[model samples]
Target: MSTSGSKDMSRRHVLGALAALPTLPILPVLFGASVARADDAPPPLPSWNDGPTKQAILDFIHATTDPSSKDFVPAEERIATFDQDGTLWVEQPIYTQIIYCLARVPVLAKANPHLAKVEPFRTVLTGDFEKIAKLSLRDFETIAVATLTGMDVEAFAAEVKAWIAEARDHRWKKLYTELTYQPMQEVLAFFRANGFKTFIVTGGGQDFVRVYSQRVYGIPPEQVVGSALGTKFGYDKAGRPFLTKEPKLLLNDDNAGKPEGIHLEIGRRPHAAFGNSTGDRQMLEYAKAGDGARLSMIVLHDDASREYAYGPARGLPDTRVGRFPQELDDEAKKGGWFIISMKDDWKRIFAFE
Candidate 1:
């Protein structure tokens, strides 16, 4: 995926709501269309609690979309990029992609028997999650690179699709897809309803996410930009064309690389950006640098009861996965980025909740 922030909507953005009179009647229109009663209308963001965070989101959308506003942006220019892991969904304990990579180790080892004797692969084969979590970054890179490469693009995607459908997060015994945050899902739909185009800019495997983005998040495959594997083109014996996944890394869609990927893939700067970690800091900065009204928001994982919370930010807890450093938190405060508190802002964590 081409990896690609504003926190606050001030008075200019906080638009007046259209309130209905008590005497007004809901009427059916000419072509059998009916006026939606204010009470019957679904809330813009139902999962979000009534607070400044929710209001800020609505205000930004209205300010940019309203023709009367100075910040009014043409619909085509309304682009919002989101980071996938901690921002859009859970990334605590272990990342979904890392789990997928590690799961494939036994199969890979079976094919190349010698791999079973290796350090990381052997640890991975142990099937003990605690030990696996302790594996070094270098070890994960080795496992991920091995698992992700050595297949045709179509075959690779197909494998991921099948796996995603069956993979369940051990904690909740729910499918990974079911673990998605309800508030974020509402934000996505709300943005689309307001004529904004949304893109998933993840640091996870590009092809892995593309397999399920549309089905799970309503984001199409082409709109995804992420860390990718290199590919080579060739023909089979029957002259059928195919692209083979290579071991070499192409784009690293994280940190400073995020803006670079966005520029390369999207061409235009996004009006807004959302993320949840230090990796997302540069992307948020990039969005804020854009002209006109912009938003830079961070989803601070501070609700351990509802969801896993680990941010060395505000001294919640420290974690190797999805780390939210105090330094990033300080920068967000100074930069005017909204730090979304899941505990206070969300009425529910998952849709299942």
Candidate 2:
């Protein structure tokens, strides 16, 4: 993959809906030839191949969008939120951002020599991830703070962008962004095409995910909401005002925080929500709680061949990063939400290979 392409998916692993209106009459004509050939045209979710999972998505969109249906929602109220990490891309072995942090410790430690002797930093400096992984959450927090803070927002973003351009996944040997799931990309485009506003709600840092969200996921910066650290606004020597990242937690944006971020950032409850792990449980529940036609779905990583498989459902690796516990599975089933099986539903994984 090209450098930009790969950089687009690099992450530090942290890690809607409906309407109908008078515009409906001209909706078909809006696409010109694509509309003219509607009957003979292929499915909008082309990446889905043909399956029950795909059909469920189609049915939900149809029911919520049809003007005649009581379930029809207005275009303006069609807000859809998606969890990043395991939902949009991958969060296996560990979060990509953690890999970035590990790589950064050595650089940062050069200036702050004490970090080299720190527990997790000491382990990270030795390049022993197995040991690093065994460290407590507090240790990981220390590492994240050390490498990710102390820089101005613009500089930090540029640094992350630069790292993404150069970083390659250890296992795939491909650019991290190159690993974005193809079917989900199609789903994103599909929602946007149908007049829904899509927002990315993730636990990853706001500054981190915003760097490439537009380029990689077609979601703009304003539409991207995520966990953020406190930032201090000040002027540099040149009197240029800037926001410097602080080693303080601003918002978590995971579990219960997901709904809080959506309400605070997006201001509207999502009409549809998609996620892949336990961190997403509250967001799914929030979407389903909205009073109109709604959709809630979770992507199950069940395809070990094309991708990693671990879940709250499938007997797979138990992970601290993206845990899919049993309760999440039971909730999804009880709520009548769709559980997308990556192994069975998707014909392809990545857009490349």
Candidate 3:
């Protein structure tokens, strides 16, 4: 069979399996059901549980979209940003990337005896997280650069792709791809339906996000803005362009850097933002501070059954996790932001099989 024919057949098989499953209520249709007047349109997210918070979201979307409404916001200004780790993806037990790095330490140890003697990498190889946490920021950076060095950009991307294909969550025994939040997927679609351009502003590697985000998050490579390592463009003897790794210019996209990265890459301020943890505070602040209609949301990892819950901020080896109980309360009182409880808000956590 031709490649296209094989692809078509594969899609048909997947769709056929999906069709055999029980039908779930369509979100847009459910939203339309809430309107009493024949000519009136209901809110974009009617399937969401009804409450003051849900109503506030609906009212904000409507007030901002309707030209006749006092709070009308222009279509050009409808940019939304989202943080990836812990917000859209699972990051418990440990950050997913850190887990990936830990898995790789033994492999590196075989080639470089120096890694076996190092503080964090040594602790990582031994699964001694308590000792790993004692390493300084510089020590962490050394391990990261050493582990990530020497590979061309394309080779590195392929390695990540392969790793993801084989890697399962330690506790769940499911592919890392399977751990994404189902409700957030709907939220992404909902924003797209409302004429909002979505961008990912994450602390994860920019190139790493670009490789799989289109398939995973429906956010394209051009729409992803994140931390970056400098690369030099060069050509070999055959004159094929290649990206060479650099020893320097690594930009970390956490905390205050979030706002700077957004300003530099996205240019315009986002009107809507979603994140989890204190790393996102600056980005949320920047989005909320924008003039006109704006909304910011934080995803609280309170659901332990569906996902791993590991907050109240435990200090991780080489990284400081944000604990924001007081800040979350303050943001709630301010009314500009929404705190989504993963336990209560989501009816389902992962996508239907």
Write model 2 residue lDDT over 111-145, tens digit each, in one string.
89997876778888987767777888888888888
lDDT (tens digit, per residue) of candidate 3 on 200-271: 988887787787888888999999989888898888899999997665656778888888898888888888
lDDT (10s digit) by residue, model 1, range 189-228? 8888778899988888788999999999999998898988
Error (Å) of candidate 2 at residue 99 is 1.1
As a whole number from 0 to 100, the lDDT of residue 249 in candidate 2 is: 86
Better-scoring candidate (lDDT), 1 or 2: 1
What TM-score fits each model?
0.90, 0.87, 0.78
> Model 1: which residue pairs collide?
1-224, 1-225, 1-226, 2-225, 5-273, 5-295, 5-296, 6-295, 6-296, 7-338
Question: How accurate locally is residue 249 in candidate 3, as Cα lDDT from 0 to 100?
Answer: 51
> Where does candidate 3 have its weakest 10-residue lDDT segment?
1-10
Model 1, residue 269: displacement in angstroms?
A: 1.0
Off by over 4 Å in 2: 1-42
- Candidate no. 3 TM-score: 0.78
